[model samples]
Target: MNAEIIGIGSELLLGQIVNTDAQFISEQLSTLGIDVFWHTVVGDNRKRIMEALRLAADRSDIIITTGGLGPTMDDLSKETMAEFLGMELEIHEPSLNRIQSYFTTMGREMTDNNKKQALFPKEAIVLKNDNGTAPGAIIEKNDRIHIILPGPPSELQPMFVNEVKPYLAGKTVDEIYSRVLRIFGVGESSVEAKIKDLLQKQSNPTIAPLAGAGEVKMRITAKAASRQEAEKMIVPVQKDIESRLGNAVYGYDDDPMEMIVIKSLREKEMYLALAESCTGGHVTDLITNIPGASDVLLESCVTYSNEAKVKRLGVSEDTLKKYGAVSSQTAYEMAEGIRKISGADIGAAITGIAGPGGATRQKPVGLIYLSLSSYGGTETKELHLSGNRLRIKEAAALHLLNWLRLSLE
Candidate 1:
């Protein structure tokens, strides 16, 4: 069924609040094999909301709305929907009891306006909101389904997941499941070219590439009778793409490079230290975000200046004088120095000119030197990236993690 999401609030139109409900609801609907056609946002005015409802009803089979279910004057969603659907608002006894109990439990007196939250359309399916006083409802009229939910995500998310998901799942037969392969160190065009055959020939399970900052993600989605069956269908396609992309494919789904590196380090019983120059300890931040990283991560030293590099990481003064700070020689020295100081099993370092500024005749902007020192030996790589300063820094940090991931392998 085709659906449309309507967000009701003057605050949303005024940019006072964000409409995160539409995104969450659309994802859930796609999983249930429902297509969302449009997202409409309307202010709290009754006329505008009714117009949006009329437009949605004329085109979409399913209309889901968030906001306007509160006790205040501008909260008009439930009443407007009732008026549009030619239904009377009836008090739900259970909802009223729950609201009264909430007030009683909090040791507060129930105001008369709070009664509005307990009212639902006659014959509508009441959606219980355990997180708030606003009880949502689903109304079916003239072959159109209108599901009204609370505005606050804290209330809407759980109500939709616990109550709305099951209800919508029952209407749909097929389930849509997707698996994403996250890749780094390859441009979107290169990754797409490698999997060009898979893209053209895909029918049941479709391959779509999503590109971001310094990474490409291939999402393979399949629809089947069951989630297990859908996942089973995705396995062969996933394997084919992974085989084509090889080590450029770092992790799958939601696993970031940092998570993969930390897991790998833990498995190998290895400890690591970082000497960051341009990335400014971002690599260390990402690693420490994972719990229990203290056992594997020894320390992070940010040597932003040439003097700091010489003093803190023991980078050679002669190397900096001859080769400059952004050179591979300095990166190697920094890694080895950190390894010696921290006594870690592995040491990684990043030095670069992440610039809108600092570009020499030989050393240009986005020229990054990454180094790793291990029991085997010290290795260094030179990279020339292109982007703004923040993007260059982010890319450099991600490259450092990817290098760690490869080393752990």
Candidate 2:
């Protein structure tokens, strides 16, 4: 079924609050073979809401709304939608009782305006809200379906998943499934050029490309009468694409590069330590972002200054004086020293002259050295990354983990 998600709040339009509810609903609806063609955000204005309802009803089979179910004067979603649909608003007795009992159990006096939460369209099915006071609704009018959910993500997501999804399941005629394969080493254009032939002739499963940072994501979606058929249709296509790309595909879905490194480290029972100069502990931040990483991460030292490098990570004074702190020898020494001091299986260091500040004719800005040291060998790689300091730092950090993931594997 074709669908549209409407977020009802002025805060969304002002950028004061994000309408994450629409994104969450769209993803859930897509899994049920529902195509979400539009996402509309409207303020708490009766005229605008009526216009949105008219537009959604004309094009979409299902119209889902989130927000403006609170007990306040600005909450006008129910009143406006009732008038637009030409449906009378009636008190849903069960929803009223749920709201009333909640206030009584909390030992708070219930105001008359709070009863507004129980108001629903006549003959509408009430969807129970276990986490909040607002009771959601699902009204089926002829060929169209209208759903109203709470605005809070905690309340809205679970209510939709548990109560509303089952109600829509019986009416669905097909099921759609999608998987995203994330690849590194290849640009988005290059990846698309390699698979343009298959993408052009696509019918059952649609292929789309999205680029971010240093990775490209290829989303493959298939629709069918049954879940098994939908998955079966995409499997061959996924395998064929993987065979063409080989080892460049780093992850699937939403996996991060640090998670890949942590997985390999824990599997091999190896410990890692890092010394940061240019990246300013960003590499450590990425590694520690994963849960249960304390088991493998030994220590991380941020030696931003020459004195800090010499004092903390034991960079030799002569090396600092001769080749400078951003040189390959200093990076090699930093990595080796950290690994030796922390007694870790591996040590990595990032040191560079990140733009706009320190630049010379000999060693210009954006020149970075990434070094890795282990019991077997020690190696350093140089990169000249462009952009501002923060950008160069983030790129260097990600590049460090990606290299480690590939090398350790």
Instruction: Locate the minimum summed-lDDT window of 10 residues in model 2.
Output: 245-254
Q: Write the per-residue lDDT of candidate 2 for residues 1-409, one digit (tens) a residue.
A: 8998989999899999989999899888888888899999999888898899999998999998899999998998888877877899889989999998898888998899999999998768889888879998888886899999989999999999998888888889899899899888788999998898889999889988889876789999999998889999999999989988877787888788888889999999999999999999999998898998898999999999999999988899999999999899999999998999999999999999887889898888789999999999889999888888888888889878877888788
lDDT of 1 by residue, 325-378 (tens): 999999999999999999999999999999988898798999999999988999
Residue pair clashes in candidate 1: none
Q: Look at candidate 1 and tell me the lDDT of residue 236.
A: 97
TM-score per candidate: 0.90, 0.92
Candidate 1 clash figure, as a count: 0
TM-score, candidate 2, is: 0.92
